[model samples]
Target: MKGRWLVVPTVAAYATRTLRVPLAGWSLTGEAQGVGPVTRRVYWIDIASPRRPETEVVTHLLQHLPEMIPPVLAAFRRVRRGGGPTGVGDRFTVLMLGVRRGRVQVVEVDPTHFRLQTLRQHSESGWIEFRSEPLVGNSYRLTVVSQVRASSWYDRATYLLGVGILQRMTWESGLRRALKVSGGRKAGHGTTTVEWP
Candidate 1:
C-alpha cells in the first residue's frame, strides 16, 4: 500500500527494539525561539491528543498543511460575502486525511496562524491540536503533540529521536530562492536577505 510504504520495518518487527530518548518533542510546547540569526520573533507551535492513533492524525496533517493555510483564509474573508470553499479544502488536506472517524473541523484562523481540532461526532472530549508559525522568508515551524494518544510505539520513538530533527533541518534547503524577496509587511527583522542583483 502507498501508505504502508512509510511504515518501513513495520510495527511487528520493531517490538524487540529498545528506544533511545528523542530530542525532538523534548522541546515541549514546540516553542521555537530565535528562528534566524538576522531576526528573532520567538516562533513556536504544538500538537497534542489523548491517544496514539492521534499521532497518525497529525502525520496526515503534516502531509497536507503546505497547501491548506492560504485558501482557508481567503474563504474565511469571503465567507461573509457568501463564497463557496474550494481548492483550499483539498489543498490543506490535513483535516480530510487525518480525520477518519470523528467530527474533524478547523476551529480558527487569523492571517499568520491557524488551528485545527477534532472531537467525537457524538461525544465531546477526544481531540487533537496542530499549529504552525510562518517564519521569515518561506520558513515555518510545526509541532504536534498527542494529549493521551500517540502514534505507534515505533513511530513515537523514531519521530521523536530523528524524524523531527530531519524535518527541522530542511529549513535551509530553499532558504535562498524562497527569500529572494521578503514576505509580510513587518520585514527587516524576521526576513531573510539575499545579496544578488
Candidate 2:
C-alpha cells in the first residue's frame, strides 16, 4: 500500500507547575527549562501558557535524543482517534486551545504521502480530526512547533518578540523533555542515549 503523510500542527496552551529534570525525576518550581543532547547537537523547546503560568522563567537541564519520539507518536494517535478511519479524503477535527480559544482546524491526511491539509473552523470542542494510513511502522520524522503569545495592551510592544523567542525555546525544551521521557521508557534508565534522526 502507498503511504500518505499528514502534517498536523497541534498547538496547545500549557502551564507546567514544575520543571521535570531529565533522567533525574527532579522537579523545579517556576519557569524552568530542560536541556538535552540530540546526538552531538544540543537543543531545547519551551512551553508557555496561561494554564501553567509558573513556568515563566528559563532554567537548564540535560537529556538525550532517543527520548523525544513518543509524544509525537501520541499526537498521531490523538488525531487518528478523533478523525476516524485512516483513508484518503477522510476528514477530522483538531482542537487547539491556547491564546486563541474555540479554535479548530479541519484536517485531511493523504495516505499516499502523509501531507496534511488544514482549515480554520470551530469544531466540537476544538477537536482536530483527519484520516490517513498509519505511519507508525514507516520511517519518518515528526516535527513539533509550539509557541506562546501574551498581551497586556501597554506591553503589546513585545507581543511578536514573545512568540518568536518562545517558539524556538519551547521547541528545544519540549524536545529534551520528550527525549528523557521516551528514552526512559525504551531503556531502563535515561543515561543510555542513542541516535535519533
Candidate 3:
C-alpha cells in the first residue's frame, strides 16, 4: 500500500513531462497497451428533442462529472498540473472511496468526443470515451464506451470482488445525467453491454 501511494507522484511527473500533445495527434485509446482480459462496457441512450443538442450534452458530461457520479464510488478532480478549458493533456486524479485511486490524462476532446487515458500507476489501464451523436429518427444518443483492463493482478482481484458493480452504476447514472441535461426523455430502456473484444 505504501509503495503504491509513493509511486503516484513519480508516475504523475512522467505524465506531465510526456502528455503534452494536441488532441488531433494523440490517439491513445490505450486498448493495445492494456493488461488482462480486455472488456468494453458501453452505456448509451437515445433522446428525443434534446434541448442541449449533441455537443452540449458531451460538454455538460465532462464539466459536471461529480454530479453525475456518486463520490463513494468515484470522483474526478483536476490536478494542479492541469488547468484552463478541458482539453488534451488535462490531468485528473480519480478518487475512489476517498483514496487516490488512479490518474488519467485527457488524451482527446472535441465538441462531440472526449477520451481519457489511464496513467502508469492507475489500477486499471485503458481509455474511456464519451461521445454524443445523432441517431435515426432525428434523435441524439449519448454513449460512454470504456475499453479497459486491469493493470495489475491486485486490481483484477478487487474488480471481481464488486468494483464492477460500482463501475456499472457510474456509467448508468452518467447516461441518465446526459438525458436530463439534454432535457429529453429516454426513447427506450437503455443498454449496458459488457463484452470481451
Candidate 4:
C-alpha cells in the first residue's frame, strides 16, 4: 500500500511534464480525448444534521461557500438582477488565487441540486454541480462534481502539478469547516474521486 501510494506523486509529476508541451494558439473542441471534452471529478462529505429539508441544506451550503473557501483564492456572490439576467441566469465570478479567473452563470437550480458553468476565457472550461441527498440517518450527503477541460497544455500541466491538489484540499477543508460551523459533524474524511470521462 505504501509503494502504491508513492506511485501517485511520481505519476503526477510525469503527467505534468508530459503535458507541458506548448500548445499555443491551439483550441480544444468538445471531443473525446479518452477523457471526454471535460474530465469529471467528484468530492463528497456526509454531515450529521437534523431532519432538514434538502433545499435548506443546499441553500445554506451555497450561501456559505464563499466564506468557507480560502478568501485569498476565491470569492463568490450573486450578481444583482439589473446587472444581468436574473434567476436561473444569475451570474457570478470566481478569482483564481486572487486573480479574476472567469465568469460563471447559474444554469440550473433546484432544491437538491445547483449547477454553474464557466462563461469566459479560463484555464479550465465546463460546469460544476452541487447536490445534497438524504442519507440513511438524519445526516445528508453533500457532493460536488466538476467537469472541466484544460484550455491549454500549460493549464493541464499546472493542474497536474499542484493546482488540482490545492483545489481539492481547499474544497474539502472548506466543506468540513462549513459543516462544523453549521452544528454538523462530518461523518468521515471527505473523499475525492477523479474520472477521465
Candidate 5:
C-alpha cells in the first residue's frame, strides 16, 4: 500500500541504489514545446490468453502501478493527488530518485488504453501511454509508449547522461511484469522499439 504514506521508506532506499543503465541510440523526432526534440520509446509484450487475463492485468495496474515498477532500479514513489478509485482526471505526484518530484495527470483512459500527461515542472514535457490490443486469436499485445523532451536543458543533459536509459528499463520491466501477471505466456519474443519519426 505504498502511495503517499510509504514514500519515506522508498526515498531512504534510494541512497543505496546505483545508476548504471546502459545507453541507447534514442530517436528525437518531434518538437518539445520549443525546448528541444521529442524522444520516443516503446516497449511491448505479446500475451497468449485463454480468458480475459489482459483486461484483469490492466485493471490491476490501473489500481496499483507500483507493482509494475522495478523497485531495485527505479525506486520511484508515486502518490495519487485525488481521493477515489483511479480513473480519468487522476493526478499523481511522482518522486523520482528521492530527489525530484513531478506531476502527471490521467488525460485519457478506457478499458484497453490510458494516457498520462506530464504537467509543468516535470522532468519531461510529453505523455506516456499503456495500451492493450487484440492481435489475433487468444492473444493480445500490451504496449507502453512514451514521447517526451526534457523540461529544460539541465534535464536534457541528465537524460542524455543516464536518466533515459533508466526510463527505458523501467517500462521494459513493467511490460514483463504485466505479461507475467496476466497469467499468460509470451505469444512471441517481446520487442522493444525506439522510433524517431
Candidate 6:
C-alpha cells in the first residue's frame, strides 16, 4: 500500500446528517438515503501508502478481502451441486448485528481498479470498489468506495443506526492494521460524505 486518503460525507433530502469520526489515522463518513422502497448509502475511505503499484495493492486487497473486512461479514466460495467451487459467485453471510446472506454478482480485476458486488433479497445489495491513483513523489493513493442498498424501512433504519457504524469502525481498524502490517503508513485523515436520493 502507498498515498493520501480522504473521505467525504453527503446527506439525503429528507434529513441532512453529517458525522466525522477520526479512527487511527483515517476519517470515516457514513451516508444514508432513502427514496421509496430503495435506500442507498455509501461509505468511503482513502489512504496513501509507500509508493506501491496499483496492481499489487489491488491484488493484495482482493486476495485478502476476508481478512480486511469486518469479522461479522463471513465470506465463502459458492459450491456447485456437483461439488465444485465457483470462484466469482461467492457468498457472504453477514452476522454482525443480524444475519443476512448475499451472493457476489460481479468481480473486476484490473491494474488500477478492482470491484466486487454482493446482492441479497432481504438484507442489502452491496458494492465495494478500490481505485489507485498516482500522486506526487513515489507514492500512490488508494480509495475504497462502498455502496449499499436496503429494500425495507426496517433494514434501512437498522443499517443507518447500528450496522452502518459498526461497519465503518470495523473497516477503519481492519484497513489500518492491514496497511501497517503491509509496510504502509497513514498520511492523514480521510473524509466521508453522505447523500440521499
Give all TM-scores, in the order shown. 0.29, 0.25, 0.77, 0.71, 0.74, 0.63
Ranking of predictions according to TM-score: 3, 5, 4, 6, 1, 2
lDDT of each: 0.30, 0.24, 0.74, 0.64, 0.69, 0.50
Off by over 4 Å in 2: 1-98, 102-118, 121-142, 145-159, 184-197
Order of candidate numbers by lDDT, starting with the best: 3, 5, 4, 6, 1, 2
Model 1 lDDT tens row, 63-99: 3343323332111111123334322222122221121
lDDT per residue (tens digit) for residues 1-197 in model 5: 54765556535533433311113212122235426566777788888863556667777777777667776544444455555668876766666655665667777777888888876656777888898888888898888888787777767776777777787778888888887778788776454545353
Clashes of each: 15, 37, 0, 0, 0, 21
lDDT of 6 by residue, 157-192 (tens): 767666777666765665565455446666554647
Could you tell me the lDDT of residue 13 within candidate 5? Answer: 35
lDDT of 2 by residue, 1-197 (tens): 12222112112112222211124321121101211211211232222211212111111111111132233322112223453334434332222223221221223233222222322221111111111111233211223321111222222232233533443444444444543433222111111113232
Q: Root-mean-square deviation of each candidate, in angstroms?
A: 16.2, 20.3, 6.8, 8.2, 9.9, 13.3
**What shift in Å separates residue 35 of candidate 3 from its native position after superposition?**
3.3
Question: Candidate 1 or 3, higher lDDT?
Answer: 3
Residue 34's lDDT within candidate 3 is: 56
* Highest-scoring model, lDDT: 3
Give the alpha carbon lDDT tens digit for every residue of 62-87 in model 3. Answer: 77766777777788887755445667
Cα lDDT tens digits, model 4, 1-197, are 99788667645743563333324422232223212245777888887764455567677766555666676766666654444323466666566665335556777887888887765345567777888788887777777887888766656777787788877876776667656654677785555555554
